[model samples]
Target: MTRDLKALLASDQTALGTWTQMVAPELVDLIGLNGFRFTIIDCQHGPFGIETAENLARAADANDIAVALRVSRNDPVEIMKALDAGIRHVVVPNIETAEEAETAVAATRFGPHGLRGACPCCRSGGHFIRNWDSYVTAEEARTGAIALVETEEGRRNIEAICATSGLAALMIGPFDLSVSMGLNGDWRCDEVQRAVTEMARAGTSAGLPVIMPVFAPTPAECRDLVDHWRGEDVTTFVVGSDKILIAEAFASWAAKLS
Candidate 1:
């Protein structure tokens, strides 16, 4: 089952997770076994497609960890495909307006409330074994969408975007936002910090969990950033990524040998 990270965050719990660009299902199992509550499959920047996402979703379920997909863009087709592949939690990136927010949310839902196409036989629906009523009910409870605010325009419309209904959370994309604002990816810039604070506050006020990435190079720095954001009511975080961790470990081993 998807771990229901949305519900966990709504309960005011701090959920920390990592990102994975590797196309291996076993990698997701490892992340879960290591005690992470969730993992985000970086489909947008990574080489993940629908098939790979399906396998990763299964791995996450087996390990009782929520698997979130960061779609390449805020496209309904891509979002719908991920959902059908059993990715219950989705992070749509580059959302710059309320309409984009609405579109992303709608793609996660079925008709009447959304525009998702029906696929009872899809993995998300249990391959048609589960009754329609039971399946729809469970799907409603499990699936959720998180909009990523990564650009200056997104920051400007943060309030309206957060106000969109059916959003489970908001993700502050620090690096992209900084670059978009002409800071050249300097997320530590005072202006970037201000924008991040405003966005996080808006999402919190809208009753949505706000997720921010802690991209520090050391554990101490990561803790510092987490503590700072915890005071801002942004409890959910992506502490790091599998790629960075692997590279860091390899570098540490080489340094020790040298």
Candidate 2:
């Protein structure tokens, strides 16, 4: 059976994913092969462009792993391009209001339901026009947009953001959220923790999945952090980015050589 984010979301399992800034599709295949359930192609902060993201989606499909594209912004064109590239999910960043969340979700749907532009020959439609009806239905059932709320204003309006219609998930952007609150990017501070708890609570109250990153450098620390967030109702965790993981490994190896 094909792996799908929808299945993961509906299940009670703790889904794990990684973020990649590198533009190589092989990295995505490796992520899946290494047992990650999903990978977010980090176009917002990473170096991914439309073409590269499309290629990454192909790799994810080959590996039977769920993939989400974090668009550079919550623009309709960006969302539409990600979808056309065959990515089934989008993570929209910096949403501070229910209206913004609504806009992001709306870009993922078609007519009467959304403002997404239609393309019968897009990669999402199998690059053909023969099965348009089934394609539309499948897209409606499978595709969704996640809201990344990570600012003081966003924290204040998280409940409303989670209340937005058709939002697939709520992700707490810890570093940005801390910095936005004048904490100097200290995601470990109490203020940031409280805000994250509140956001997770709001997400649960709204019946949405909550996702947060566990940036701890050690396996023990990562486990502790996951346990901490799990207590707050966070269902998904992104352990680290490709760059961070590689850099850390390189440093550890160099230390051993010394």
Candidate 3:
């Protein structure tokens, strides 16, 4: 699965996926079966607890799709819990320094590099092996981490953040990044564009893949933005959220009725 994401990132392929606050396993199964390369469980803004997140992860796994989580904060407990729930990849928001990035990596990794609390009985550890040595080695190899470059602080420290080893990729949070640039929701501002471009370059230099979230004003606009980003060599594009799809469909039907 990591190989697949890496391939998409390397070749700049358009990976279509959605963000969900709803942690229902059925929804996860539906999305995964539909051939999404990945599904990001938005634990930060969504009402997902550890149990629900785990269920979603299991559902995705059953369908052979990668299940990733976006943490609410850069807290160790939050990062550790997500990893233990069988989420192979985690996207941490608002990372501002190499130290924070290091902390995140440590929380997700096993001994030698990180201090992630040991849990032999957890699903991640294959259910509490009596022999500790084998479990630790396996855990370290499976987990992956991603740092979000959202705020101006994170953007300014892009090179440092990307320089951290064990990080899988750097993701751009369009809304947050736009606000951080003082554009206040204006994603088209020249400053926002320049910052994203710069960050993409930084990711390339650091040997990390860059991911961008596209919340377009319209479906046509979404396709256009995807094309533009693909041209720039951004392989992973999170197209839209479930909320947007529902609201747009409902509004369109309502307009037709009216």
Candidate 4:
């Protein structure tokens, strides 16, 4: 169902997702329809306006896929816009402290619980055809706010960050984290591995699960990676993106043609 992602996350069950870097709604639908439990609409690097993002969100939901938006910034407007577009999950990047995590959560809710502006006519409120306040209350209950603990500073403070009340999960930004630790993009380096392990431990201690990313160059490699994380006790992971899938397929085609 559309609530599958939330249910899985809430139950501490394994939730699998895929990245959507392109603005194409068709790709979003296909990603969800392909059996992924969730999809992250990457707004940070993907050029999409509120309308386009909303269209994509609707597409994913129509296929019974939960949608999350990795907003461009932790700014309240960016977060609000994402939710207003009917996305139930919001991922804020580069969160290094509890205060930042709180802010991310605050941006997703109304007053008392949060500071999100309320509008009855928006997609979030069902276009003013229903009770606005009731809609806000219900939507917040279904929402998940995830914090990206990417940098060295962020990883060091991960426990406290995860301790934020409304923050749902800690998402590892592998590339940025590798660069932050001076690993020079060596995600496989021993030092980088240690950092990853420590970060996961911190989240575990805080009573939160870490959202890991599974990246691979081939389908078999992807399966192996998922199995490895499952053995490592990773309850949630996102598969590689539409971009990576196309790249892999194209590379294989070029090799065969050669």
Candidate 5:
């Protein structure tokens, strides 16, 4: 499969994606088919079993949506498992140092940088076919490894992390970053805004795209951010999470009933 992610980001296209907590295969398939450019199978906080993850990956593939898995940690086992299940893109959360970023790159690969045990039975390895070598090579070329920088320390180390050769992008996890900076959920605080802006500049200077997850906000607010960033032409935005949508909907309904 052609990796359109890099191209999409490069072209300054508005690629819409969602973060899913519902990891069921059917739901994943439905979301993908509904025109989501990509859907993240959130393994970090979402309830997703290995088998279900595999099924969801397959469904996303079938529906022509890119499957990116958000691993809870920067563990090699979790990274390899997600890759084995045919997830080509990975978002590793809370990467605070150059060492962590290096470790993440290693985990995503097969030999040099990582200790990933190759399994021919895995979907990514072509089920151990005679063409396994070709499969691995091609897969390696298309795979994306994103580092989520969500801390004051991570912000400080942004340049080093962006300089890492294999890193595809630097993702800003605003919530965690806000808390880390003692903003305590005040994402609009001057300190938080400055940090995010500097991080974006660093990533762009290093020739890496910056990705930001836009949480629950009015459509106008979302558009304003998108327009601003899109004008810069170096960042990709993933619209709000499914969990937030569900909560908002329920809260609105409760208000109506009352």
Candidate 6:
């Protein structure tokens, strides 16, 4: 069977994913083969067309890494296209209410699970390899739906959003949240910390893992991030991304040259 993140996280194991902002499917395979259990294609900020995103998803799956498409907005088409293309998990940005969360979750499901349009011809559904019943059931079993609540309104509605059904995780877009609170880039402010902890607590209360992003550039920093979130109970995040890794490597090379 293909690697499934929802299945893995169900066992209380950490689900480690990398974010891709560039259009390279090779990076997905490289990170997947190395250690990352999943990849989140950044359609929101990245220059990703549907074809490229689909190819990226396929490459990650080929390498046994689950794929999560950080979709563009909360639009159903964006979510639908990602799901139709084989991405099993979706992290939606700027969701601020339970109703928005409900819509996002509904887009990921069909019939009793959600109101997603049915079509088995997509690559993710094996290009109609399975019957409708089997496909829907299998997809639902393998899929995870996550909501990114980054604004203060989202912060206030955290509990209700987390409590939404068919929603698997509540994610923090830290920088956006910081900016929303007028803290500039100073995400270490006490207010930011409090908001993050509130999100974690709300997820815990709702029986879901709180998705976090740890932007460490070195082994030591990654370890520090892990230690920092240890008390939060939930364990999963986009640990780092190609941009950070490449930036670190480039800076080291520049230092050597200098």
Predicted structure with the largest TM-score when compared to the true one: 2
Report the number of clashing residue pairs per model: 0, 0, 1, 1, 0, 0
Q: After superposition, how far is residue 209 of candidate 2 from its true place, in Å?
A: 0.6
Error of 6 at 129 (Å): 4.5
**CA lDDT, every prediction?**
0.86, 0.87, 0.79, 0.80, 0.79, 0.82
Q: Write the per-residue lDDT of candidate 2 for residues 139-178, one digit (tens) a residue.
A: 8788999999999999999989999989999988999998
Tens-place lDDT digits, model 3, residues 224-248: 9888877777778776776776678
- lDDT tens digits, residues 1-258, model 6? 347767655656677777988898788878888888877889998987778988887788689887788888898788888888878888899999999999999988876667777786987777765678777788887776789999999999988898898897788887789999999967767889898888888888788877788876786877777777766876886777888877888998999999
TM-score of each: 0.95, 0.96, 0.90, 0.93, 0.90, 0.93
- Whichever of 2 and 5 has more TM-score, that candidate is 2
lDDT of 5 by residue, 1-258 (tens): 423565655655677777877856776666666666777778888887667777777777778877688998998898888888778888999998999998888887888656566887877766664776787687777777899999999998999999998887888887889999888998877888788888888888898888878774565787787787676664567777766655766888899999
Model 4, 1-258: lDDT tens digits are 145456666555677788888878888877767778888888887777667778888888788877788988889888888887778888899898899999999998887778787777777666673676677668888877899888999987877897899777888887788999887877767787788888877777777867887776678977886776666667788888889877887999999999
Runs in model 4 deviating more than 4 A are 11-13
Minimal lDDT window, size 10, model 4: 1-10
Better of 3 and 6 by TM-score: 6
Q: Which candidate, 4 or 6, has the higher TM-score? A: 6
Candidate 1 residue-wise lDDT, 14-78, digit = tens: 78888988988887888889878888988888886878877888888899987899999888889
**Which of the numbered candidates is closest to the native, going by highest lDDT?**
2
By lDDT, the better pick of 5 and 6 is 6
Model 5 CA lDDT for position 232 = 61
Candidate 3 CA-lDDT value: 0.79
